[model samples]
Target: MMPKKAENCISCAVKLTGTGFTRFPCPDCGEVIGRCAKCRGQSNPYKCPKCGFIGP
Candidate 1:
């Protein structure tokens, strides 16, 4: 098996990767394990970068 790659990474835009500390999101907090261009980072006092919706 080989690693995956993006052909148009520069052209392609990702709103959020949703990859946090763990693969699964917090059941109570709804935290995700990913990167948000808007948020810069994930977790604690988290909010939706796309909509500014704060996490519970």
Candidate 2:
């Protein structure tokens, strides 16, 4: 089996690339989340899919 790659940016819905996405755990549930470089740089708000908690 292969490791799953990020499919899209959680904030902007942009297609993700190997070097353009950042992966981190959701603060509430510890679920992995993916954010694109552009959004991260711009401080775009992201919601946790597992808990619906929103944050920058």
Candidate 3:
């Protein structure tokens, strides 16, 4: 099954709001991943909570 979309930034656990936050599907598990502007700008690595898939 497709995983639910993440509500907060995966790397920082910050609430996603305003501009620059992104939501995309995990490459490995099709789970939605969330990234805040700061983390995305820094290229922080995020793990898919459902499948253990990590990406930067």
User: Which stretches of model 3 miss by more than 4 angstroms?
Assistant: 1-3
Off by over 4 Å in 2: 1-5
Using Cα atoms with residue i matched to residue i, what is each candidate's TM-score against the true structure?
Answer: 0.26, 0.77, 0.90
- Ten consecutive residues with minimal summed lDDT in candidate 1? 2-11
Winner on lDDT between 1 and 2 is: 2
Q: Assess the local accuracy of residue 15 in candidate 1 as a C-alpha lDDT between 0 and 100.
A: 35
Worst 10 residues of 2 by lDDT: 1-10
Query: 1 or 2, which is superior by TM-score?
Result: 2
lDDT of 1 at 11: 15
Clashing pairs in 3: none
List, residue by residue over 20-56, the lDDT tens digit for candidate 2.
Answer: 6798887897767789999999989999777898988
lDDT of each: 0.34, 0.80, 0.90
Local lDDT at 44 for model 2: 92
Tell me how far candidate 3 lies from the true structure as C-alpha RMSD in angstroms: 2.5
Tell me the spans in candidate 1 whose CA falls farther than 4 Å from its real position.
1-20, 23-43
Position 36, candidate 2: lDDT: 93
